[model samples]
Target chain A: MQKTALTRRTLLLPAVVILLGLSIFPLLFSLALSFGDWGLGRGIPYEWRGLSNYAALLADGRYRNAAFNTVLYVVVTVSIQYVLGLALAWGLFLRPPGGRIFRVLFIFPMMLAPVAVGYMWRLMFQSRIGAANFFLAALGFEPVRWLSARWFAMSVVMMAEIWQWTPFMFLFLYAALMNVPTSPIDAALVDGASRFQVFRHIVLPMLMPISIAVIMLRAVEAVKILDTVYVITHGGPGNTTESLTMYGYNVGLQYFNLGYAAAIAYTLLLVVVAIAIPVIIFFKKEVSYT
Target chain B: MIRLNSVQRWSLFVALVLWAIIVIFPLYWMVTTTFKLRADIYAGPALIPWVDFVPTLEHWARVVARYQQVTRAMANSAVAGLASAAAATFIGGMAGYGLTRFQYKLGFLRNRDIAFWILSNRVLPPIVLVLPIFIMFRTAGLVDSRAGLAIVYTMFNLPIAAWLMLEYFKQIPIDLDESAKVDGATYMQILTRIALPLARPGIIATFLVCLMFAWNEFIYALILTFSRAQTLPLVVAGQATQHGPQWWDIAVMATITIAPLLLVTILLGNRLIAGLTAGWGQ
Candidate 1:
């Protein structure tokens, strides 16, 4: 027993130390920094300020836009991805010819760097020589100005987001649907239950745990989106699509407002944790096979 | 036989086929545009590359001749990805073993609480960690260094790493350890000899996941390194700013950055799918 305990400490203590060194220490340091004013790039000395940056961000338009855009993105992307991902998984379940190839292609975009993926979308969205416009002209429709307006830019960003992640969500749903029991479905079919009714009652509930899990995972990630926006829009056309992550980046790196940036970062952390806690609980319950 | 109507089956097939084509179109466009000469790209947009003009390798050539950071960035990514992945796997294995094998009573913190805390650290946005780590690393003179950035990557990877390894370790039969202990085997001996061998596939899966995280890490690298330690993603992004958006170069760089990972995932496609499945619902 003593040996077991000794070995346990020997193994776990190092991990605990590493975890603390990496997360807790930095979190505390940043928490402290958030309450103090520091403009390191401008040669300003660190000065203590109590919650001023937090107060200031309440009225900061860009911060509000970032927060709104981030939430909007999470909502749009998660819902669309989930709905479409379920559709595609059902479609793919039919085992179409060249599906083997299609699966390969479907996952291709995700394998690329988000920067590269965003850049590719940006190139395609270009006005002068974009393929989207080219195809539009061929079909006799006028080319939509993709990135000119706020809603249009958000739409394009959302498209890129959906196109990349829907495959992942589809993959998850596919696995879940495959493993779902088939006897009940066959029995319902023999009992003359309509396809939609059988699906509404049987398959849907069976897939509920997986669906919720997919949404929770996708929702958490979608909320912290930065890469595509950074590369494509750069929060352009007057800060229309700046995520809180991007807002934090601008404050810290561009404006060199370290204290305010820390505050922005902390708020983002709280928002993510707050949004994610219930989902995380549900996730634990589902994963334990309850 | 599985039951479905002919129309339903065909429609589903057609739907899958069409979407697959739509998905493949942009990726194919990106790759083919890399081969198109400046004239062809600057001119009409053709769906087929070689039919309009013979594809060229000039852009790929320019990635080496005009832009050289691609190579440096590749090297940087390899260092960080390999180092962090390997380190995290080993360290996480230890933590995982401890968690699975022993009981913990640390005042208010139970084992589940500790696990949740570790995983929740991952939920903290990179921005929260980026600024403070930048300051701390700068003060410690670890900025712009591969080791420094690898530590940060390891931090992010560690949560997943420990969690995954813990799950994998749990799958191994504890009875093996009991028998080993009866034979006077130390915990270290049992872990190294009995447990590690049984958990081999999990280790590889965990390693691959860590490498995926490390290789794709962007925000932290952007804030921490200026130029010397730039990763492939950073360099690929740099193509936009370096000379006012060289599409050809960007295509080439993006191709380089993506090809290796694509190949890795394809080769390990089944394993990756398994790992990703494990990631969901938990």
Candidate 2:
């Protein structure tokens, strides 16, 4: 293969154009659209409504509920996945025979589409004829309505999110765990350290960076997740499962309040960025260290 | 080391087996529900396929013989997936190769900045971007078109594709490029012939990932296409929705929607995870 002379000018322009249209354009346009009174009305007559959409959405009870749900969802789901994933990773790190199969199975849920996952669990969580309630009633306990109430609806959403994503944490944590130089672990074991102690001191510190990054990534994905909630709850039981993204979509697409939705979308962006910036910084630091 | 006694070993084995069952339970439920009658499905979550329960091909038959839109959506998804994979592989691959291999004397601030911008853009939520994209597509008269969806998907797929390919390309020492240059070959020739061949695994990994992203994408498909260019996820998801018809048919279609992905994941799960986490930690 012969490499002909190529100048920087030849390659840079197309990349710029792709990134511009994809990333730059949407970002700027969305920001601009947030400020205008664009909706389902005949064409967007540019009426600069400065902070009205934001103020209105903030005052709206629905947006506040969605915001609260989003924060709660992120904290609970991330915490569960992180803890469960680390436990699973440590279990697998023991490297008993057939460990590889278990590892693959652990990460299996991550591969399916979120919508499929939502449906699969929706069937499981079915109160009347669903498996979960069936088992509950079999044990002589009352079968609770999983999707019929606000708290149970949120619980079901959390359950599905955990089921789907714990595997992601397992995968990343396992990857980082695998890369942890085995000598240190072995040394701790030889020095009469228990597995738990080794994990607390030697392993957790080493895995903290990847764990942080994983939390950041999972949190971002969980925040924007619409397909699961869209399928499972449809933000239902009186807007109990309505995340910020779902709320934004409802205002924009369902209600045709484009400007209000745009503002909502921008606010969601800020929330995500607030989470993202730290992760990005952590990621850059991790990258530089390596 | 608490020396694992036989009892401990046996207990560990039991725990592993139990967890394995839990992990695979959902997948098993999905597949089995496809063959079950509606009554059997609603009848207390039978772990074993019911012996007396009649296994009817009705759901499959209904989906195949009756539903034409699903078939059309499947086709749209395939077209969108393959087109985006090819476009992303070619353009993003070239961009990946250029960013990794090409060095200008002045150092390309523009090039590095473009790469950074692409990464940041990937993090931008599609909901935030969909309206702007919708407006743009409507203005261009490309709304509700397959190509429109493809363009949007291509944009999302490109960043990771480029980043993936860049990492893969960087591993192929510049010696190849230098040697190719010594042979007085064109840069395009080196890329297409040498770098591309050496990076075949990387390309396939990237292709599978991009195709998966395209095939399974929902939000953009939901927003961009109403009836004309909707994807499999949109169709299945829409069908299963509370407002839509034939809830059991959703089980059928969800089965169908997940089958291809299941096959791909089971076959290429390792490569998929590796490709996804390539630069995340290391």
Chain A TM-scores, all candidates?
0.91, 0.93
Docking class of 2: medium
lDDT of 2 by residue, A182-271 (tens): 788788889989877888999999998888889998998778878888888899987878988888888878877788888888888887
Screening candidate 2 with a backbone cut-off below 3 angstroms (N, C-alpha, C), the clashing residue pairs are A2-B185, A3-B185, A4-B185, A4-B186, A4-B187
State residue B179's C-alpha deviation in candidate 1, in Å. 2.7
Candidate 1 per-residue C-alpha lDDT over A104-209 given as tens digits, one digit per residue, 9 for 90 to 100: 6666666667877777777787765567887788899887878777888888788888888888788889778777777998899888888778778988898887
In order, the interface RMSDs are 2.6, 2.7
lDDT of 1 at B259: 81
State candidate 2's TM-score: 0.93
Candidate 2, residue A66: Cα displacement in angstroms equals 0.7
Error in Å for residue B186 of model 1: 2.8
List candidate 1 stretches off by more than 4 Å.
A94-104, A142-145, A287-290, B279-282
Q: Estimate each model's TM-score.
A: 0.95, 0.93
Worst 10 residues of 2 chain A by lDDT: A1-10
Q: Which pairs clash in model 1?
A: none
